[model samples]
Target: MDRTPSFLQQHKQTFQRVGAVLLAILVWQVLAMAVGHQLLVPSPLSVLERLAGIWLEAGFWSTVWFTFRKIVAGFLLGLALGLGLGSLAGRFPLFEILFRPWAVMVKSVPVASFIVICLIWMSSARLSIFISFLMVLPIVYTNVLQSIRSVDRQMLEAVQIFRLPWAKRVLYLWLPQMKPYLISACSVGLGISWKAGIAAEIIGIPSGSIGQMFYDAKVYFNTTDLFTWTIIVVVVSVLFEKGFLALLKWLYGRLEKL
Candidate 1:
């Protein structure tokens, strides 16, 4: 097997990334200075100042918690449903046939349409959960199904021949094979869930949400606030993605040791 990149190489790459980010910020500051108006393009420093102010506010944490809870709930629910359905579809032709049309529709439908329709049927407070679930479900389902299909037939046949219990088969064979796919799906799906959930919140104007803050910023023409809130969203989204994926990898490692 090929060896992983050395620590020195990884550190070099990290420094390069940091350098690139600094260069981009420098360019942004120069442009903002040339514009001579905060409205047009606020300097990076101004946005950072606004970020600091927002960071100190209790409402900021509340909004973060509110959105985080809803998004996580939706993501977990979608993951459970997708895994169950995908497993069934992978195992049985009948289940795959039954779910095919629905999966197709989900993958094809525009998120905006789902949000509008959901708004008519559900409360605004629940809109984020619904939208996030909808956005994540298809991706998880598809990725998991693909993973299932990719499982080694020889290994499966060996398990069958040995008459292993279903649970044993799943724990020993299925899960190990599906690790990469599940991880990939979660990484992509979590980001999608956050984006869709926030978009839904914006449209639904849910009280005390990050999306609502963005909406308020727009209403007041507070571009600095808008940029700051957007920065918060990006930071939170990236952090969540990284944290969740790391957890998943750790769990997989533990499972392998077992």
Candidate 2:
């Protein structure tokens, strides 16, 4: 086997990605200078400086913590419901028929409309959690149900013929098959959850939340602050996705090994 350096082999793409980000930032900085109005477009350096300041503020961490908890709770709730409902629907035609309409309605209805209506029943503080849950549920349900349905009939038949134990079927068949669909659902779901959650907060303007700060930034035309907060959201969303996917991939590897 060739003994190449791990960082060189594994992180060449990482270096390329970092270069791309730097290029984008350079372009943004140039555009900001061309605009010549700080309110309209703050330079990249100004935004970075603002972000650094926010990182040091005690209130920033509190806001982040609150938002993180709400969004993550919503995501977990949606995932659980999706798994439970998807399994039922996949196993039984009746369940599929019963659940598909609701899922379709959730998918078809505009998220804004849901936010408006939900606000009436729930406090603004809880808006993000509910909206996140609603947005993520359909995607998860569809992916999982499809994964269940897409199991190769021939392989299933072979397993049945072989009279394999349920544990073996799960280990060799179901786990392998569900891995991709689960990862895909989660990857998509988590991103959307953060987006929807933040949007909900922005609309609701819950006090002391990042959304409130974002709204303040917009209201006051604080372009640098807006850019800084936007960067924070993007960073948090990306980190959450990467961390969650890493956990999912690790679990998958462990399951496969078993």
Candidate 3:
């Protein structure tokens, strides 16, 4: 007989999530009615209708795909560079010293400043990639460096005593120890990448981008379109985050089994 709790069953949490979403939409509708101005706050129904309209447009899909490609490209590049740099910084004091100021600056500087600076240096089409990379780099670097520092000294000593190969030590010990930090870094970095990338696109207004649609909506004062596009961004970002994190979790499971 299956002894699992009912709460742990499939679709239990799904139903709860759907109920919560419906409740939130109802609250939003009530609040919009109370406000009595679509400009100030669009009704949920109006936004949904706008979303449906946009969903039928070929241009909408193109813009979404363009923005998505740039965001993903930037995120991956930043993730790779961050992992490499963090490993170096973690392993060598000199490298850490050299990179510390840059990491600090990246972490502390306002994203708007980065966007403006990048706009002057490159075409609008590439701004999202650069901005997203900039936003994600320090996060991944800091988290990974911390993870490396936090590795157990006893484990290192054991590896040394066994005279294990460097690759073996790194694979079995270092990578396993850093899994939590890597996961945390990825979660934070992915969100930052999307936020900063979209912000860059908005400011730059590149053709064939979600940001351009947002800009056009603002220019025309189309509140419904604006709300609809904003919802699309949120939905896309959430879906990407969920998918990426699930993949990360699966990778960690494989690593653990190894």
RMSD of each: 3.4, 2.8, 2.5
Q: Write the per-residue lDDT of candidate 2 for residues 1-258, one digit (tens) a residue.
A: 978888877899999999999999999989999998899999998887887788898788999988989999999999999988887898898999999789999999988899889989999999999999999899889998999899999999999999999889878988788889999999999999999999999998888888998899999999899888888989998999999999999998898676
Runs in model 1 lying further than 4 Å from the true structure: 1-10
TM-score between model 3 and native: 0.92
TM-score result, candidate 1: 0.93
Pairs clashing within candidate 3: none
Expressed as tens digits, the lDDT of each residue in 153-249 for candidate 1 is: 8998999999999899989998998898999899989989988998998899999999899899888888888888888988998999899999989
Model 3 over residues 1-258: C-alpha lDDT tens digits? 988767647678888999899999999999999999999889998998887788888777888999999998999889889999999999998999999999999989999999999899999999999999998889888888999899889988999999999899888988888888888888988888998999999999999998998899899988888888888988998899899999989987897787
The deviation in Å at residue 89 for candidate 1 is 0.8
lDDT at position 236, candidate 1: 91
Q: lDDT, candidate 2, residue 135?
A: 90
Clash numbers, per candidate: 0, 0, 0
Instruction: Give the top-scoring candidate (TM-score).
Output: 1
Against the hidden true structure, what lDDT does model 1 obtain?
Answer: 0.90
